[model samples]
Target: MSVRTQESALRIALVFPGQGAQHPRMAAGLYGHEAVFTAAMDEALELLGADGERIRSAWLARTTTADFDDVTVSQPLLYAVDHALGRMVLDWGVEPVALMGHSVGELVAATLAGVVGFADGIRLMRARIRQFAQTPAGGMLAVAAGLGEVEDLLTGQVHLAAVNARRQLLLAGEREPLDRAAQALRERGIVCRDARARQAFHSPVVDEAVEASMPDWLATPLNRPRRTVYSAYTQGVLTDDTALDHRFWARQAAETVHFAPTLDRLLADHDCLLVEAGPGNSLSTVARRHPAVVRGGSEVAPLLPDGAQDDVRDRRSVAAAKERILPLQQPVRA
Candidate 1:
């Protein structure tokens, strides 16, 4: 469809979850049951090559991984699952007003937006996982406080990784420093949760590590997105410069995600349904806190149940999510 026609379509915004949102058996139920989802997931994993095989085996076997958060496992898996879920939504005949994602989730959205091809994204992520794997052991923690409340707690190693919501923040750093910071928060009566991650993503410690990506980025094909995209990295609508900027993708792992502001920009433009197409309700939870949603001017739909829920069937959740978005599209378009 033409850009003008696409712009005139219904306003449905998809928000993708980043790292730490993963868990065992996420979307496993859809592997054989749902055609679109199954095909998309299979295609992505196949493109992932060897690592894809490993992930697929473990997922189907339902093996409990000791370090499920490690980038090698988490990144590729999330990319595949998120991408598949996004494709499933599109299959429902919904056209999003824009696409937005948090952290690595941005890459998933970019892939769907045609900013990067599926095979190329697989290449970039595989290369990224290898590079990130070499970094020193580190961790990420979600703290329930604004930067003002936690700025003094940050060290050279432990820095702000993400601003997820008004008071929801994430910190990343080498193991000890991040743990120490988390301890401090706990002592101060602030709640903090560990991310299922081993690499201190978005930390400067990885800045040099990402430098090696210059060649990879240059070698990879880059293109402007055919669809409107919002970037948490840029805290605004994605521009051609940002989309095609090799440096941005290269440095993404070490840069803080400004998800709150990015979502604000999207909602400011259109009162759309927010569908989180990922493993968990992390993005959905954050979206609920927005005033537009709370006042019923906007809505939030989750494509999957929380990773914490062992009984929630992913396929059923997809059906439920479909019902939520499809019914609302006509009203929003009106």
Candidate 2:
């Protein structure tokens, strides 16, 4: 495709993630290219009084998926990488018409959208990590040939976390009941597996944690966003500072994410270019499942000029896209 055509077709939507996407080396390439991103990461480490280098190296390390499963470490690191990448993309001048963050990734999305300052977002992440850390939680996995059937299977012990599609669902709660539910699904020939996550994030268990952290989160200042930021909690476009309330943040931790609802609402009016702004490719994978959306860039070195390539980790074919990164600008609007 020609550059002009590609650019014209770009109606970007910046999508942020919650958890389950992190690695030590996720954003190493952008360290030099996007210093502000690096600075944001450094600030995150400073908040914890830990070595940033060690943290980066830990994520970059090639290890089993289990190695990166700790909620405390994963949450902050995910934010760092996503925030860094989001800044790099904005610097590249690829403005999105809309922004949506999944779970914790919402903070990164809000930061990039100008809804919240970077530093404050990082601070909130730190507090959020601590607040939600104490609660005991676990995640569920199921591949449903039929999603409707599984709805009846959810018990009080387990709750739906994410709806990846009409056919895929994520359940969260205590471990034993979740395992039993998985076994039941398996009996039905549904593909169900346990997620690597230790915490049942986005469930009722985290309500107290979120509530304790709310006064502090709300105290964090709000800034005007560059683009419209939609909230999964509200399932609508966020237009005011009041959007960042206790109920919103609390529900983010305690409620199941109706991603389909949020995505459906956003895609209806906009020709969206969905950019998964984070370390791992989970959000991007989810976006690809939707026929209406397309990917922006990935993590490999020297992909897009102004460091856009490092801003996102494109799980697409790297072998075919080794061309030197190109400098880009906003295409003229129709």
Candidate 3:
């Protein structure tokens, strides 16, 4: 693909979803048809060794949710699929001007943006997952309330995991407090659903895991991102001076994911075409609802279909890409 000047470059933004979006046999259709995607998946499986086989079997079996419920299994599998899908989009000549990720999905963005090598990213994810699995098991609740509303109901035990949107907040902690908080929210006629997370990610409950996994995470080499990377960790764009080291990642695991702020920054800075490069439209759905996205007339698309229709999925992706190109040629305004 030819490079465009700063003024004329297509400001495309690729967004990835984290956990809670995984399902069996996701992107099974694109695997065989797209050579670049196939190579990426095969390489990821090879790097994973036995765990690779386990993920592959789970993908093929398409059986139970338990197959992906394990953090160790889900993290690597999601990374592999998300990375491959991003590569497939690039092969289609739809290069991103920026990238952002939700929670664990940041690993994929980091790799694509040249912050870390592909293999090292996978190793870091595996180590992170294993350490998380060793921690005390907890739960997360998706509360339909703003941060202020949820904080009003919080005890000393629970922590805010993610600020997804104005009304979408994820609360994480021990089962007892989580349940209590959910009950309290429900009593007020607020919607609260179980996130079904195996561990209390992005909360103080995983401090032990963060400490255990620090050495491996720090050992992984990192550089300045080749493209702009919006950080859920800092709730802004990652700059040259921003540290992309072990401490940063550890803090990320133990801090609230400021996804809404990151989205706001993306919309304010660029005329971005937001593409969800994961199993489902989870992130895309959220992007569409953002006031900035709606007012800016930003286009959002998903790379894979929710169902088993492989042919239809391919057609939709192609059509969406074609549609994205036209609007991207227009001048961007804040």
- Top candidate on lDDT is 1
TM-scores, all models, native as reference:
0.93, 0.82, 0.90
- What is the lDDT for 52 in model 1? 84
| 1-334 per-residue lDDT for model 3 (tens digits) | 3445556444778898887777777777767767988999999999987678877888756565574666778778889889998887777766677899998788788888888899997887777667888777677888888887877766668999998989998998878888888898899899999884777888899888888888887788878889788998887888766646668866677788989988988888776678888887778878889886677546576766653435556556755665765456445443
Give me the runs in candidate 2 sitting further than 4 Å from their true place: 1-8, 50-54, 64-67, 241-244, 293-328
Candidate 1 structure lDDT: 0.84
Indicate whether candidate 1 or candidate 3 has the larger TM-score. 1
> For model 2, what is the C-alpha lDDT against the true structure?
0.65
Q: Give the higher-lDDT candidate: 2 or 3.
A: 3
Best model per TM-score: 1
Writing each residue's lDDT as its tens digit, candidate 2 over 1-334 gives: 3354644454656677667655456666655555666777777777655434555556656553453666666777878877776765666566667778777787777777767776776677667667876886566464554558777767678787877566767788777777888888889888877665777887776668878887876687666666788877677787675454545654677777777778768877676656666655566666666656533322222222221234244323221222222232346465
